[model samples]
Target: MTVRRPAAALASLAVTALALTACGTDQQAAPGEDKIKVVASTSVWASVVQAVGGDGVEVEPIIKDPSADPHSYESSPQDAAKVTDADLVVLNGGGYDEFMTQILGSSGQGKPTVEAVEDEHEGEPAAHEEHGEPAGHDHAVNEHVWYDLPVVQQVADQVATELGELRPAEAAQFNQSADRFEQEVSGLQGRVGEIAAANQGKQVIVTEPVAHYLVEAAKLQDITPPSFVNAIEAETDPSAAAVAEVQNVVNARQIVAVIYNPQTESPVTRNVRAAAEQNRIPVVEMTETLPTDKTYVQWMDAQITALQSALSQNR
Candidate 1:
């Protein structure tokens, strides 16, 4: 795997032997004074954890930088320390946050972990009925479960369940918060369903699979060439033939919009965006991580609203 993405490279922290008196006691909370310590791999998961934990838990997300690519996240000693102090850990899993695994292992903390991808609910209907294959399903599985609204809802429940295990006393509060979040997010999901219903069978081009879940949720057809998107997701350069295939799709003007990932940039993504512009197709940029300025629901609502606006123009 020679995949590479832009990252703030971090220096590996070396552990040195210290005198027994020099090392103070671990900072982890003693068996329940109330606040549960949580360590999340990314901001998206962190936001969900925070929503569920409410005032009962303190969440520390390792990759909170909005400008950073979660795929390219680099771990540091500070992140490991956070994990060491956590009562529970939440990660995207499915190979998306492999760095978190390394950090946890180094920390030697056997904290209970919750993996969102592993618990993803299945058998979702394809947004675009015209496309024979199920929406969000392909030869290559997209590990971006956060973009899948239903999956996010399911993961919210999972988080509450895991967090509740750590603090049985506040379990009811955690469940209540998750239920509220689900209800609120359902309103957003309803909006997406309505938009998809209005523009059924519409097609789109994506630079990567970051927004595939949302694209499917909106019931839009993704016409992006698999070779091109697969290469981008793999962080490898697509062959000239693969790039040309994407160019042909853009030239054909068959797609209504281009879903671009501004966080992960490459020559291929840039070329696709350039081609979309030349062909007069609207390009909407989406991110994998939650924005620093907005909550998860707000971030998702904004993206769907932008897509609706852009797609409406094409119609």
Candidate 2:
């Protein structure tokens, strides 16, 4: 169910991405015809678009460094250039890429954009700030919606719908990709359910809450204090109280597993990892960008495996 892309294929995708970073792919346009130029706000969004659009569509990725925290990214002139020519844009809305909205809107292209937010789309509130502001709600919506299979399905659906509208002749291909993509998401949901159900309610701690939705899907209860969560979300190191509470939680063996954002890790996360180790708990380190070789489900299955291992160690 979880097919791993061959390294060769990934290498090819990477090269293709690099070569076409600033231009549309030739495969996108027919002889003497124009192609649909699109700008995806993040690499994750771009990947999802590529998954659905395949070679029929051309996407100019705004964020080249997939490892950088999208929450704090600034738009470059080049980024604006891409949006200006794009017919459509895909955004991880939930405060994930607010900077993009302005850039794309002002492009004179009047490009239509799809915002994949949590409410009725993903689940919970976005866990972090977008462009540095709270998502205007309290539930920590998983801005990393691409990691959440259910919401990811919604995102793919929205994308396919828009793509279909843009090029009706290619609607069948778009619909096919959407169907396959949705099936993959459903399969991932089942796989994650299998793993999470095995250790439901086990407590876990997150450094940045980047993949909290997947963690919750794995049935792991986050023992990371809301204060600490807020601190990391706000991009400010935790206050003394939050740090102390988090340290205590780590030291107290309050959680069985610890997961961290390797890309934007802080000393506080390192401390949490140390505490987990001191307590002999296992830790899972991950990135905001999903692995290139993995489908969302496979990547999540790997995380659950880490969780299962961590929970076993805790016991």
Candidate 3:
């Protein structure tokens, strides 16, 4: 995807770079500031940090707007300053939020950073290759790893470990909080398992693969044309044949539901949604970040619930 950094954003970044040079390498909290300052790429990861850190850390998400697309997000000087000042930084990584990666790279502060994708699969090969799929298609290593509950659990544990190292006095508390968060994640996983048991192999379609991992967890088959998914992710129009194939699938009601990502909606996707609605096929909404006033667990739980409801209603 093309990321256009505005001139103002570049100027802000330059100012932040200068400020960091003046401040030197000190990344500690200010006097009397007890909370560990945590900066996350989006509210999804921020919610995870908040759950594990509890009262011990003050978390800030750079992309808090629900409608904002992380792929094309423009970073400002304040965002860079946040990364420079943060004791710990959390990111989804895997090229999903290149803006955060850019800020972290430019900050040069060497703060403790936890990336959900890279850190979760530290020793494993590239996920798409491991699955024996091409890089950018249906079976690719989806960077939206937040939809993968097991990965989320691993990330939470890492967050606790990182926080423990920062404030050794509260190490045990952080671990305990992560333990509790894991239990909740386990509960969410169980729900996904239930969906799998009830509707394994059920066919569905998506505008983009934002919930690829979640759909996989439930053993649902995403019949979205690979070309269509690739084009949507690349922010380009799919070939005429690809678009026609997807429309045919929807018109025929061949899929159980249409998994739609409204955040990345386009005219083509909108037309697909309209076709699904007209055919009375369910359209389940998923997003890249947390919805308003929701914790990570709450957000995933709600999506899983919606998926189950969609399947049952179609049945």
Steric overlap count per candidate: 0, 5, 0
Per residue, candidate 2 scores C-alpha lDDT tens digits across 107-149 of 6233445566623233333322232322222444546666667
Better model by lDDT: candidate 1 vs candidate 2? 1
Q: Candidate 3 regions off by >4 Å?
A: 1-33, 119-140
Model 1 per-residue lDDT tens digits across residues 1-315: 010011211121111111111111233233357588888899998898888988888888899888888777788888888888877788886568888868866773445566665322332212222333434345334677788787788778767766655566566788999999999799889999988888887988788888877788787888766777777877899789978878898899988999999887898789889989998899998998888888888888898899889988976
RMSD for each of the candidates: 9.9, 10.0, 7.8
TM-score of 2: 0.79
The segments of candidate 2 whose C-alpha lies over 4 angstroms from its true place after superposition are 1-34, 118-140, 291-298
What are the per-residue Cα lDDT tens digits for candidate 3 across 131-158? Answer: 4343336533578888878778877887
Sequence-dependent TM-score of model 1:
0.82
Q: Candidate 1: where is the Cα deviation over 4 Å?
A: 1-34, 119-140
CA displacement after TM-score superposition, residue 246 of candidate 1 (Å): 1.4
Backbone clash total for model 3 is 0
How does each model score on TM-score?
0.82, 0.79, 0.86
